[model samples]
Target: MGSIATRGDSKRSGNQGMIKTHSRSRHKRAQALAEMAVMVPFLVIGMMGMLDLGRAFYYQISLTNAVREAARYGAQPYYTGLSPACNAIPPATSPGASCPVPGDQNIKDRLAQELSGTGFVVDPTKIQILPDQGTRVSNCGTSGSCQYALKVTATYQFTFITPIIGDLIGNPLTLKTSSLFRTEY
Candidate 1:
């Protein structure tokens, strides 16, 4: 009877050890979960900031390309079948049947169209054709004769999606791009 009692005591101690190990494992799992909960918000914010940075870079490139295309278009002389005509002044009226040829208004239209593909709503009012309607000569140097160039400028207000970052740097940022090209006619 004494031996049987000793054997039963050993079995009870082994069971108690297993129970302790199981509880410790449970505690560790809980600790890991608590740590994850604390870190998730910070990770999400960091990802959002990266996203905003990428968006801003993409938008800036798009604006630059659009302005460049518009300036290039404006620098060329319009062909009128008989000869290449360099129109010094753009039509004062709005774009319609009155202004059929490619001019300053057309340049603005092309810029707006290019920006439309970039997921940005372009305001026509923000597009500016330098010299308003005509070409200007710059970089004359000692030659006394300068090359004709056209300049196009555009502006857009970019809004940030990240609340914290937006607050840190004004919610809506203003982005501007300009391009100049020499006349090819």
Candidate 2:
């Protein structure tokens, strides 16, 4: 049979051990919270950087697609901008009777229409549309001959959502995409 005194002492010791375990658990919880507070900012900033980078990449791809579409439009035989000025022989400066080349503003409007819903604003001044008639080896009057090459270029401004990243990189990164296509006149 166990003595009553010994049983009482064991119970008290068990209670003290439980109290010590509770105290250690509280300390560990506080330490974990402190660590989380220190790490959270860095984690948030990293996530923001990734998000911004993804957005920039998406916009870049969109801009490239827009330019490709615009170039495709210009590559058609019907677009006035694709017509060569003065198909005459060298030294003959007379502008031919073809419809006047569509002005930069017209081309810009077409590009803007293609860029609609992309969340990117394109500047007309930054865009350049040019026709390479001199490079055409085949005669335009011939059937099934590619006449002229149209070149379209534009720059997209990508703004970052996070200020820290913006300061590290430029406020707005300029991403440029150009597309050239031969006209099927």
- lDDT of candidate 1 over 1-185, digit per residue (tens): 99999999998998999999999999999999999999999999989988997898899999999999988877754544332222333223322122233567788888888878788866889888876553342232443323356678999888999998788878788889999886543
Q: At residue 164, what lDDT does model 2 achieve?
A: 93
Query: What's the lDDT for all of these models?
Result: 0.72, 0.72
| Top candidate, metric TM-score | 2
Off by over 4 Å in 2: 79-104, 132-146
Model 2 clashing-pair count: 0
The Cα error of candidate 2 at residue 65, in Å, is 0.4
For candidate 2, the per-residue lDDT at 102 reads 38
- List residue ranges in candidate 1 displaced over 4 A: 1-8, 79-101, 135-146
- The TM-score measured for candidate 1 stands at 0.76
Relative to the unseen true structure, what is the C-alpha lDDT of residue 66 in candidate 1, on a scale of 0 to 100?
92
